[model samples]
Target: MSADAFIAAGPRPPRAGAVATTATYAWRGLLKVRHVPEQLIDVTIGPILLLVMFTYVFGGAISGTTGDYLQFLLPGILVMGVLLTSVASGVILQADRAAGVVDRFRSLPSWRAAPLVGAVVADSVRYLATAAVILVTGLLLGFDAGGGLLGVLAAALLVTVFAFALSWLFTTLGLVVRGASAVQGIGMMAIFLLVFVSNVFVDPATLPAAVAAFVDVNPVSHLVTAVRTLLAGDPAGADVALALAEAAAVTAVFAPLTARLYGRP
Candidate 1:
């Protein structure tokens, strides 16, 4: 056939196998990570610096006891670390979409879920690293996990699941937003609002009545409290379950929204 005839023919159909798509996306994500080792540094170093600064600078004023303060602050830091790492999802998604990577993926004969699933799976490494650094920093600052090793592991897993859910929310935002800068600004604002308004630095009771009421119901506060209770060997009350449920609900709401947005022309 002439070159023109060959060019006129359509491209081969994409393979629709689930396992193949998963593996392809997984490997692609891993390869991207290998090329960008510096990404890991944020996960590791950010937590360390935050933990140290918070414990040393404000520990006395906050808790009147550094040890107890570390115990309380470390869990908040863990949640913050995971949330911080989640911002990268938006950043990366924005970059990919801007650079036409998502378009290229759409052109390919791959599973629709591959890109999203792969991104979340790969980003879990960052979440894990951040969690580990927070735990280590807590240890160095004399914070102990009163619930023992299993409790610590469970808390880490909880944080990871939360981070994964957050990734979906941010990914949708990134994909739908006009540009990366907008995504970053919005994500940062959201993070700051969630973290600061929660019972992260101060006891919610000490706040103004209106602020206290809002903070008491903030999901981030519930997550931080849950992590604190788990670390301090206290009861895992309804708060923890509530936080997990909220995170799950967020994932459910955003996952389909993202999928629909991503699938659109």
Candidate 2:
């Protein structure tokens, strides 16, 4: 047969399947976490060190009372913990790309969105683990969750959801970038800017007027405030809603973009 006839005679690749593909990718991601358990060390240790150092060293200087400081600082650390943990999503994506795991998956007859969606879902476990470490450490340091167990759990779930949304954004960045190292650098820079520029360690009003304005509007600040309010049993109607809205908006915007980019060479 002629080349054209041979091309026409062959079957076309299968259309993307949704449920099975997403589940398979999600399982693969969970397996990766199991194999690389050491990755949890940073998440666990970082919060502890930050809590110890800030409460002992800078706590008195900043808040004049370590007890009050722990309450204030722990919430910011919780936000930071989740944000920092989300950076791993980008690194893992870059690694998968470099190792050709993504290419191997792409060659299969599965859903195009599976790998992207599954990665985010799997990484959520890590977010939950990190948040737990932060909370336990905060409790040891005399931080109270006046909002009670349910509220604390709700705050944690909120952070996990936010982290999942962040994973989508970073995954897209990893797909667009050439190397894992470059992606790591970019991810670190973004996290630092988000954490440091917000009301993480100090009140935004204490910062310069321009800086304060930016921090007030920063989504991280709102998230931190919301978590703190929940923990303190304070009303968090608008702030919690805003944080959820932001996470939803981010996921809605980036999840499809990452899937499209992942499907491409």
Candidate 3:
């Protein structure tokens, strides 16, 4: 009677598919922000502050007009905003590991990488939100997009892709790092170095030789340049290609590493 009754329950509902498990974990990631709304401050409010402060405080000094500076600054801000938000991938993952949440996921009869991949997928929404908020703010402050709607969408798509790749790198960091704060600190330092060393705030041509060399090679610079070119209606084929390649390389390298580390007992 017991065996027949169990068999009639339909093979334990055939375990969730990969997509279903991934989406469920992704939704779990979003629910964390719903309960703690302040988690979005870095992506939303932080970018707005940076946009306004940088555009107003140094805009006249650098570009001679806040209006003109806004044009140049907005795209860079998008890159910075989304990349910075990506750091949370590592921090939150580390927190989950410490809290035994990840261990629980490991015990489930689902894809092993779903929790990791889904966390990054959920953060992709935060990246898009950051891009949208910053873009809207830039427009309100008199920034214009010459590349039109299609270009803007392309730029947002590129930034999200790059941010997704970068999140994998941070997710690897989460797997290896002993504490959430350590992951956060390292991730922030890494991002700050990338942003500041790139051509985000200045032209590489104007910088000194050694610094300019580094800026010329910075992936963030390529991403910002691609975004700017898209916004300005210019041919960004080469820039976009290079930026995408960089993103692909990051994902190719760290995704496997994260999987390997996450699989460890």
TM-scores for all candidates?
0.91, 0.91, 0.96
Candidate 3 C-alpha lDDT tens digits along 1-265: 6988879976566778899989999999999899999998888899999999999998999889999888988999999998999999999999999999989989988999999888889999999999999888988888899999888889999999999999999999998989999999999999999999988887788899999999988899999999999989899999999999999999999999999999988
Q: What is the Å distance of residue 184 in model 3 from its true position?
A: 0.8
> What 10-residue stretch in candidate 3 is worst by lDDT?
6-15
* Residue lDDT tens for model 2, 64-119: 99998888899899889888889889889989999999898888777667888888
Which pairs clash in the backbone of model 3?
A: none
175-230 per-residue lDDT for model 1 (tens digits): 88988889989998998899999998888888999899889888889889888887
Best by TM-score: 3
How does residue 46 of candidate 2 score in lDDT?
Answer: 83
What lDDT would each prediction earn against the true structure?
A: 0.85, 0.88, 0.92
Off by over 4 Å in 1: 1-16
For lDDT, the strongest prediction is 3
Candidates 2 and 3 compared: the better one by TM-score is 3
Return the candidate ranking by lDDT, descending.
3, 2, 1
Report per-prediction Cα RMSD to one decimal. 3.3, 4.7, 1.6
